[model samples]
Structure formats: C-alpha cells, structure tokens
Target: MAASGRRTGRPTLEEVAARAGVGRGTVSRVINGSPRVSEQARTAVQRAVAELGYVPNRAARALAGSRTDAVALVIPETEARLFTEPYFLDIVRGVSGELAEADKQLLLTLIRDDKERQRFEQYLAAQRVDGVLLVSVHRDDPLPDRVRMLGLPAVLNGRRSEAEPVAFVDSDNVGAGRSAVAHLAGRGRRRIATVTGP
Candidate 1:
C-alpha cells in the first residue's frame, strides 16, 4: 500500500518464494537460517531478496514467533584493545566459520558499563538476535546471569562452571597459560606480565 492508500504492488513473502522458485516454507527456512536448506536454495532466495528489495516486517514476524534472523558475539571489553587480542581473533574465526555455513550474520556489541548494558538490554529486548555469544566476562559478572533470565539462549566463550547453564567453547586456558610462560622462559625472558584484562 502507498501513502495515497493505493496498492503499489510491493513484494510479499509469497512473491519472494515464487521468484526463488521454491516453496514458501523453503524461502522462510532459508530466511530464518534453518540448517536443512540447501546451498542452491539459499542462493536462489538471496537472489530474489536482492532483486525484489524485500525487507522483512519485524512487527508481523514477531507475531509469528519468527526470529529476527540474527546473532551476536558480544564482548564486554574496551573498544581500544578489542582487535589487539589474538585469542579473540581465533575465536572470531571459529565463530565466523560456523555462522557462515548457516548463512547467518554476526553483530558485535561492547558491553563495558552499566549505561552501555542498559542500552544493550534495550537493543537486545527487540529480539534482534536469535542468541548471543558472550566473551571476556568476569567470574562475578552479572551479564550472563541477566541474559539467562531474559529467556534468550546465550553461550559464553570461556568456561565459567560445569553447573553454570551457559554453553561454551573453550581451549585449555590453564594449560595454555602455563605453556606460554614456559615458552617465554625458554626464550630467555625473566619478567612478564599477563595483561589480558582491562
């Protein structure tokens, strides 16, 4: 519908599916990042999205319980040193690889304060992400606990606890940390400072 209350023939979900030569459900599955979709179907749907300039209606989708089709790898770290950490880069690479296979995009958020976390809650409450992957949280951090209370599926990058509900992927941090110091010792460095945190 146009501002003049006339139909402008704007594309609809059905049209998009038809243009992609796939069923409506298939189109939706692709749009929602369902792993069952084939790459060929995914490509066709993406082509239709580009050709028709289709923009999903968030309000309507909310009623249907459709996800916003997004995810975030939020880090509670300072922006200055965000990119300087090699571990973050490796983890990002691993995450990017998995997310790319699903054709899902990752949004990054820096939650470093009460004010920022407040704003983060507002944005997250919009249901923009299907889930969240948080990194660099402290032992006593309240963010992960808060995220769980919101009924959102969240995973921590580092292992916090076995009893903790947050799902995570972590390396042998303790063992790796020890190996790093030993390697430095063999390199003839007598003094070192572990500055992994702010």
Candidate 2:
C-alpha cells in the first residue's frame, strides 16, 4: 500500500518496508541507525519514513536498546485503603502526567500484605521496570530495604523514619498541623484534638 493510504494512524514498520521495497529488518536497521545496512537500503527506508510521516515508538526503541522505559509505582496499601484514600489517586495522577511527558509507562502495584510483597519483590528481581516509586511505606515494611538491596532506582513518597537511606519526598505535616491548631485557638476552640495517620 502507498504511504498516504496508512496515514490515518501512526505508520507501521511493515508499511515502511513495503514502501522502501526492502524487508522489515532493513527498515529496523535504518531506523536504529545501524551501519550494517547498505546505503541504498538506508536511503530508501529514510525516504519511505519521511514520505509516510512515520514517528518511531519511543517505548519500542527503548526496548530495542535493552531498556523498558517503564517505572513501577508501588503502593503498600489494601484495596479498601486505595479506594478510601485520595492520596494514592493524587500520586498516580501526578506521576502519570509527568511520565507521559517523559514518554514512559507507569506500572502500579499495591502490596497489601506479606504475600503480595514477596511476589512483587520477585517481579522486581526479573527487571521488569526501569525504576520504582514507593508510596506509603511504613517502617516495618521490608519493601524499602529489599528494593535498596536490589540496587533499583527507587524513590519513596515518605521516609520510613528520620534516617531513611533511599530518596523520598515528605510533606511538612508538622507545620500544617501547627498552623491549623493556631487558627483553631484564635477562634476560641480550646478542646482541639490532633489525629495522626498511618
């Protein structure tokens, strides 16, 4: 088929191959900038690509170069917790937006209990994702330590404690709470109680 005929969506490699009068491997080599392909084949493939207005899939290209271009967003919460709390949803939204800009995919995994946690650890060991983002990990959770030992690029939403080894992002809960209490006191609400969360 002609290059213009397949312009409705992203043009595939086969269309480029047919247009270039070469095989799929030759087109792949040309796209990957391999020197093994002949100059004639490369030029033909390039012209075909230009004519087709072909844009290479970043994820496929990354995989061709031995990279996944995927990040795992690990949430250590039960199904009930995930639905009841808006925090996880907020994190997923922000992460998804940012990752889309970067042309990466997010693999969300919720490790509710020890069994799931162990299974996830095994999956990580297989190098499924390029990096990890851990959310709501408590001190007792072994995920942080296990992820660290795997030498994966991992970031936590909050630190397990004051001396967390891995990278983490923490909100100023203390400052926010203090400001709230002061505001309440100013309104003559003396019987205020501060409730902490897990």
Candidate 3:
C-alpha cells in the first residue's frame, strides 16, 4: 500500500480490475458482500489490489448501496441548541447504534451561518464523506442545493418536500403535532392555539 503514486491520488477499482484480469463488476462484488467469486479470481483480485495500491472511494461505494459506510450529519443549528435538542440526541443515538451494526463511521458538522456553510460545502465537495444526512434545513438554505448538485447520495433529516425531492429520515412531524393538540384538548385546555411555521 505504501507506493509513490498513491500520494493522495488513489487509483480507481478499474485499475485494480485491469491488473487482476477481472471485470469491474467482479471487483465490485469482491468489495461488496458477494461470496459468489471463485477462489482463483478472489486471489487474483486481492493480489492486484495489493500490487497497484488501490483504494476504493467511499463516496463511490455509497452510491452502489442503499446505506453508506460513512455518513456526514450536517447540523444547521446553533452549537448551544445542538447539545440541548433532545430529539436530535435521540436520533443521533439511534443512528449510531444502527451504523455500528454495519461498522460505519459518523461525521458531525455544525453550521450556523452562511459563511460556515459555504466553507462546509468545499469540504463536502472534496469527497471526504460517503453520504450526507443534512439536518434542520431551513427554507432559504443554499446547502441542500449544493449537496444535490454534487450528485452525492444524500438523506436529509426532518425536512424535505416532494417538489425538491431528497431521500430523508424523519419522524412523523404532522402526526406528532396532531397528537400534541389532542393531548391539550384532553386536558381541557379550551381556547387552545398552535403556531406553525418553517
């Protein structure tokens, strides 16, 4: 793995496949969880990978599967509130447990303003993350568009619209809202009111 040409500019799996005398699919299957490969093919692929000093890009691998080996959770919240937000904490815990079952890493980023978000976009564009899970997206945020434009696989947490169309994981916000109102009614809190806004 310690080669001169591998100076941060990693070779593609195609290079490994070429060296191994296998198709890209075979290489991919080997990288993934496929056990259908022959012993000879497996040895060849492994040797070629070792010889070429190839590294698979996580972002590319993320696209091939529904879940990635690494996911960046973008929090567009104040650092103060990020710690206090109980729901965010619960979501993070669940995400951590689920990802640990698959042996993945979690990257956390907190962006509170435009300047920081712009800088964060550059980091995201560098392909350091396999997938992104953006949280607390506001209506006028530019970052969602930035993530979408990069063609990276992304899943927004708590916010998405069909018109914009993004993969996301969210609690039943509307249902919870209704439940809150019902609870208030059950308590006999007459002249009740609720405020809803983005």
Candidate 4:
C-alpha cells in the first residue's frame, strides 16, 4: 500500500472491476474487446481503465492466452552488414511499420552463425512468438525448411530460387531489366551497359 492508501504497484483487474461496478470477468471481456460485453459495462470498464491508468501485462496475457502476439524477423547476416546495407534497413523499416499497424511486437533477430541459428530454432520450439519473417536467405539455407517442419507461419523477404517452395516476396529482376531495356531502346539508345554486383 502507498502513503495515499492505494496500492503501490500497478492496478489489478479486480480493482478495475470494482471501480467499474462489474465482475472481474466483465472487466476482462471489455479489456480483451469481446463482443459479449454490453455497451454500458464496456464504457464503465474503459472509464475505470483510464482513471486507473491501467496497462495490461503482456507476459501474463500471453501465458493465459497461449499467444505472444509477437513476430520474429530473422536476418541471417552480420551486424555490420545489417546496419551498413540500405536494402536491409529498408526491409526493417517496412516490416516494423506493418507490424506496428497490426498491433504486434517485432523481435528483430540477427543470426550470424550456426550456434545462433540453433539457439533460434530452440526458441521457436518454445513457442515464444506467433510467427516469423525471414530475410536475406541464401540458396542452400535450411532454416526456411526447418521453420516449415515446425509448422510455424513464416514469410521470406526474398526467394532463394525461382522454384522456392516457401511463401516469399521477391522482385522480378529479369522482368524489371527487360522493361528498363525496352524503355531505354524506345528512347533511341542502343549502347546498353549495366552494372551489377555478385
């Protein structure tokens, strides 16, 4: 208890229920956005929450619901490469934005070696996150297949090959190059020289 006669720590669900003049379950239903809650109860609970400045304990909620509401974005690259490459930075930014909109947490993971990859697989087996998003996959990388075997939801930022079996989002480099060349040729340019990296 505090000097003011209130609890010193964060407000509890029971306290909110008492303040709202409803049962504990009603408060929970209102907080969880359940349709079963009546408008009057919902309004009362919302008012109580606002007045108490209540914030839900995510870990407790996850334990109760069996959902972490989190997504792990696995990038198999060195910290130097991850920070230095604009392509990687762009992917992080885009994923962060989308995850924010969905009200889900993003766990950005950098796996640089086999040990770290093994650790991540262990974490996956623990069911720590709801889903995964993989980026910067190599042609022969087995992590994608491992994730599939675990029956976890995953999306790859880019495909390892044209016949990639996993769900992936990739740009059509060949089609893009063809379109660029056609556009350039239509403008009366014949000497087409391009630069690419290995």
Candidate 5:
C-alpha cells in the first residue's frame, strides 16, 4: 500500500470501491455498465473513477471474463509478398475496415515457414485472442484444424477443397473468367486465350 493508503501500483478496483463507499461487486457492476446498478451507485463509481484517475486494466478484465476482444488475422506469407501483392493488401484493407466497425482489434501475423507455424500454434494455445481469420491457406496446411481443436472461432479466406470443414469465403474464379471472356467477345475479339494460375 502507498502512503496515501491505496495500493502502491495503479489504482485498483478495490480502491475505487473504497472511494465510492460501495462494495467491490457494485463497483464492478457499475464499471461494466450493468443495468442492475442503481443510478446513485453508478454516479458514485463514476465520480470515484474520475477523481482517482482509475483506468480499467484490460488484461485483468480479459482474464476475468474470458474475452480478449481481439481477433487475429493470420496470413502465411512473407512480408515482401504481403506488401507487394495488391490482393493481400486489398484483403487487409477490407478486413480492417469491417473489424473497426465492429469494435474489435485485428492482429495481423505472417507465417513464412514451418517454424513460425509451430510458434503460432503455441500462441493460440495461450488463449490470447477471441477469434482468428486465416487467409491464403494451402491444401495441406494444418492450422485450420489446429485452430478448430483449440475451440476458437475461425474463418478462412479460402478453402482447400470442396469438403473443407471450416467456414470459408472464396471468390468465383470460374464466373470471373467467363465474365472476362464474354466482355472481350462483346468487343469483337475472336482469339480469346486465358492464363490460369499454377
């Protein structure tokens, strides 16, 4: 405890409770915006919080509620590729915009090798994120299954196969190709050759 009779570190929930002349649970309820708290108690907690300059500890609150309020967007690619490739950049922009609207933090991770993949698995095991968004997955990548096994919600940008068990979002390559060809044919281009990916 400090000489002021409060804890030595940052002002804790108990200190706020003491200042507000309310129980610890009442302080918590008021801080969490619980509707059950009476107007008078809420006003007291707010006043105490402002007077003491108390800021809620996010890490402690996450541990208590089992919610980090953060989402990890894992892209297994090199930094060069992530920056150079317009597709990856577009994905990042779209995901960031949506996550911002939803009030969630986005953790962008790039796994370039087996070693990094293993390290990411360990990080997931620690339950540090609320959910995961996996992009640019390979056919044999094991991360999708590993994320599922950890019991965390996950969504893949694309699927490995038609029978992919994980939830995914993918573009219509065939439809896009057909549309492109039709556009060229409409412009009276006879010889239409398409280049496909490896």
Candidate 6:
C-alpha cells in the first residue's frame, strides 16, 4: 500500500485506523461512541487515537448535518450588571455546568442597547447557535415572541406573564410576594407597599 502523506502535522482518521489495525469504519464507530463496536476494537482505536493526538474536525462534522454544538446564553442587561449582580453569576454557573457535561460550547452575549439586541436577534434567526438561554427578560421585551416565531429552541429564565407562550424556568415569584405581604401584615404593620419593575 502507498504511504499517506502527513498533512499539516495533524493526525488523520485513516492514519489512526492504520495504527489501530482496524478499518476506517471501525475507527469511526469507536470515535463516535457507537455501541456496536466491540470492547477489544474500541480499546485499540482509543489507544491509537490518544497516541496520535487525533482531534475530530468540527467543520466537517457540521457539513455532515451535525449541529454546531454551541449554545448562546443571552443576557439582556449591561455588562456592569452582569458582573456585579449575584443573580446573573448564579445563572451563568448553572448554564456552564450543564454545557460542560454535554461537551458543548457556550457563547455569552450581553444586549445593552437596541442596536446590539437587534444584531443578536438576527444572529439567532440565522441558526448560528443550536439553542438559546435567555436571562432577565421583561414583560415588554419582544425577544421571546420572536424566538417562538422563528422556531428556534429557546428557554427563558423568567416569563413575561402568566400566559406566556414560550418555555421558561423561573421561581414562584407570586408565592414569594404573597409570603412577604403576609409576614408584614402579621408584624402589625397597617401600611404595606410593593414595588415592581418593567
């Protein structure tokens, strides 16, 4: 057989297969974590892969109908608040933890102004990210409606209203509000007030 030339000093799939003493298809199955591969073959392929430092080409994977394996954590707030606020930091940590387990990349984008918000919407509409995780969305924001209309996979940290159409994950704000009022009333306070945000 003819010797394959090294291209750019990166190990290729064919080379891994040769080193593992298996066919290219077997190597592919092992790399892709297919259950059909046998234990012995899988071990050999893994050893060869590690020895050669083989890294799969993500661009090629995308061309083969695979997702970009990336998600966007969209925070509709200023950069200063995103860093200063403990709430945003907790959300970031949670999202990062889940994405790390799934081996997907996270793209954090902050929308401080209308221009940047519009640009992000256009980017999402282009399907650049596999999904979106929107945080700190208010009642008046049109982003949830746009995401639903575009048929992109999205999850919100909060809902706009009780009848919100999109999927969201939020705490029981109403329950907390009621509990606060009850506590105040129990403390013999005749005057109680609540503040809300847009």
For every model shown, what is its TM-score relative to the native structure? 0.60, 0.69, 0.60, 0.91, 0.77, 0.79
Query: lDDT tens digits, residues 10-108, model 5?
Result: 888998999999999999988777899999999999999999889998788888889897899999999999999999999999999999998778899
The 10-residue segment of model 6 with minimum total lDDT is 1-10
lDDT of 3 by residue, 126-147 (tens): 7767778887887677787789
Per-residue lDDT of 37-131 in model 6, one digit per residue for the tens? 99999999999999999998776666665577889999989889999989999989999999989988899998887898889889988877888
* Separate clash counts for every candidate: 0, 0, 0, 0, 0, 0
**Residue lDDT tens for model 2, 19-46:** 9999999999898778999999999999
Worst 10 residues of 4 by lDDT: 1-10
Candidates 1 and 2 compared: the better one by TM-score is 2
* Clashing pairs in model 5, backbone N/Cα/C closer than 3 A: none
Candidate 5 displacement at residue 98 in angstroms: 4.2
Best by TM-score: 4
In angstroms, the error of model 6 at 36 is 3.3
In TM-score terms, candidate 2 sits at 0.69
Tell me the lDDT of candidate 2.
Answer: 0.89
Clashing pairs in 1: none
TM-score of 6: 0.79
True-vs-predicted CA distance for residue 62, candidate 1, Å:
6.5
Per-residue error (Å), model 3, residue 135: 1.1
Off by over 4 Å in 2: 1-50, 57-60, 181-193
Task: Give the lDDT ranking, best first.
Answer: 4, 5, 2, 6, 1, 3
Off by over 4 Å in 1: 1-63, 161-163, 173-198
